[model samples]
Target: MNTTSHTVAVLGAGTMGSGIACVMARAGHRTLLFDVDETNLGRGLDTVRGFFDNGVRKGKIDAAQADSAVANLSGTTDLGDLAPADVVVEAIFEDLDLKKETFGRLDGIVSERTLFHTNTSTLSVTGIASGSRLPGRVVGTHYCNPAPLMKLVEVADGRHTEGWAHDATLEFLDTLGKTSVVTKDRPGFIVNRFLIPWENSCIDALESGVGTKESIDAAVRGALGHPMGPFRLLDIVGMDIHKQVAMRLYEQLREPRFFPPPMVERMVAAGDLGRKTGRGFYEYDDNRLFGS
Candidate 1:
């Protein structure tokens, strides 16, 4: 893995944002995690620290390595603090207008050469790029959930995205030891296009009494060669997020398979929002945002 340090800023202090920041810092980059809310920012920072500390406890990284990664991470409430960033990754809310407005506002802050990467899962890259004056520099980088653990990153170029920006984005992901898969700027990119429907099917199977949640998860892990079953993955992703992403794709594609199963509504309503809420398909001792 490349250890050369670079200045990277991740917008939004949510689980995804903090996870990506942890990945960047672990790769020796100076990562600035930004959020408008001070409380959220603090919590996000704590999440990142928890990830590094867990690595030490698990023996995945030594104490010195963990300390170095933690030292490379910082939190900021001010967007102006991101001025020195070589790359600014926008992982804020999934709202298109909010994503657009963010890149537009960053135009005045960062250098023209800085890459603007939008982590929009359902929105069009072209639509988000329309907000920025430097549309050529705008690229779509959809990181799988739990960014620190996921090795694959989907790289999609907007209609106006320049070849230089696309190349640079791929290179940046490489530095972080991430596998970059070039994908179309379409909704869900590569992973979600298949994952959402498959997850829905799994839910349907469980709901229809074809198998219990444990049996279904075990079947997937044992036969399909997945690290975790649909239920376990959903637990990490949060049931609310699955519903939102699934519904967004369904609404856009007009596909019945993209619709989340009815059980999703019940789980979300019950506040069983996966690990973040201490329960989803299973229970957790603590409400950590991601798995160790």
Candidate 2:
């Protein structure tokens, strides 16, 4: 699909969803961002606005461009509003049943030509598509966290995904100035295949008193030239999400290294969900990391 001339509907209004909406809008597509509640939809819009504002401040985009992107972006509380979309991307929670249910509902609402994409990082695209009326139209378009800044989107072809659907998704993402890698429908895909295991190891080390979070993060930063250490990345990704992904990968790959450590479970159980919740492996005040 030529997304430039079409409308893109993004389901869910969380961080990833809102950020993906910004990317679509900025790419000159009329983007409809949908959520179940008014507050989440409003928050998603605000996040898009904030991204544009920051882009202008950083000279990444001019005020005119920002205005145009914002003009192209709209928020909706009704699933029915997405019927007119040419492409629908689901950025809901990481649960398989929930994703399948969402896609099943969307099948009834959207046109058969409307391409269905899921922003699932670990779940099977084939499994999600199995619940859809048109499984051949479903594909996985997994955008990394903070989608507006992340340039790489993992495109996965499910067992039933048609060649045209996969090709069109790649073309659409390319038009959005995103680099994509095609991967078979598998747990964790490429980036997470390497990332989740490393993170699991980092948690194990932390739990074993290998080093303090600060020292370990600093060592990785200074020695390995990493942008952020595993712990900090885990915190940013949300400890609960980290644990969930780890468990999923472990279950599928049966790799001991992918298992979520006890510390991660305890932290998630404690409701320390990282930046969003103001606590996780580290403490945050207003989303700013204050202490370990």
Candidate 3:
């Protein structure tokens, strides 16, 4: 399908998924945002509106343009409605089996030429693609958190991904005003490959009692010029999610350093999931609170 002829359907209306849908809609694409839960679907639509409103208030986007962008977005709770999409992006949970199953269903619904991409952070794109009927059409389009704001888009060409499917995916990302990096089907691709190791190192320091949370955060910010320290960043990203990704990476690579640290596991077990849960490495009373 030509770019204009295709609609971008994003499955899951959470932070990342909603951000992606907003990006597409802002780019003037007819974007569909789908979620099974009513509350999530409503929140996702509200997120899109809030994003454009912020842009307009900041003079980044005119009110007319922002309204049009929102008009381009439609939310739904049904996956079957996504059959009309020329490109479907699965941006739901990080569970591999669930993602594989979703892709399999999407493969059956979408046309043979319709491209499929997953916003998976660490799962193997090849594994998901292999599980689908149209493996050749399945690729990875990993976006960072706050997809509407983040410019980096990693495009993964799985073992079977090639030709028009691959090219079209890259084009789609470019049209969304993102900088696209085409990566081979490899563990963690580019960003996570290096960033994950750094997170692991931070965990080691914490375990070794290198310093208190405050000291470590201050040191990283002051000495290394990092905007936020590793632990503080983990709080925002959610410790549970971070640990899950680390464990999966460690499992796939069998590298000891990639192992999820004990403290992270402890926190997850205690239900200190992070900002979403109001407690994590640090405590929050709403305003995205952080700690040392």
> Lowest summed lDDT over 10 consecutive residues: which window, candidate 1?
1-10
Could you report the Cα RMSD, in angstroms, for every candidate shown? 1.7, 2.8, 3.3
| Candidate no. 2 TM-score | 0.90
Task: List pairs with backbone clashes in candidate 1.
Answer: none
Please provide, for model 3 over 23-45, each residue's C-alpha lDDT reduced to its tens digit, 9 standing for 90 to 100. Answer: 88999988999998898788778
Question: What's each prediction's TM-score?
Answer: 0.96, 0.90, 0.85
TM-score for predicted model 1 compared with the true structure: 0.96
Q: Considering lDDT, which of the candidate structures 1 and 3 is the better prediction for this target?
A: 1
Query: Which lDDT tens digits does candidate 1 get at residues 1-292?
Result: 1236789999998878988999999999999999998987887898889898888999888999999999999999999999999999998989988988989999999999999999888999999999999999999999998899889999999999999999889889989999999999998999999999999999999999999999999999999999888898999888988999999999999999999999999999999998878889998885467765
Better of 1 and 2 by lDDT: 1
User: Residue 44 CA error for candidate 3 (Å)?
Assistant: 2.9
Please say which candidate is ahead in lDDT: 2 or 3. Answer: 2
- By lDDT, the candidates rank as 1, 2, 3
Q: Write the per-residue lDDT of candidate 2 for residues 29-121, one digit (tens) a residue.
A: 999999987887886788788788878888888999999999999989889889999899999889889889988998899999889999998
Off by over 4 Å in 3: 1-5, 58-60, 203-232, 282-292
- Give all candidates' CA lDDT scores: 0.91, 0.85, 0.81
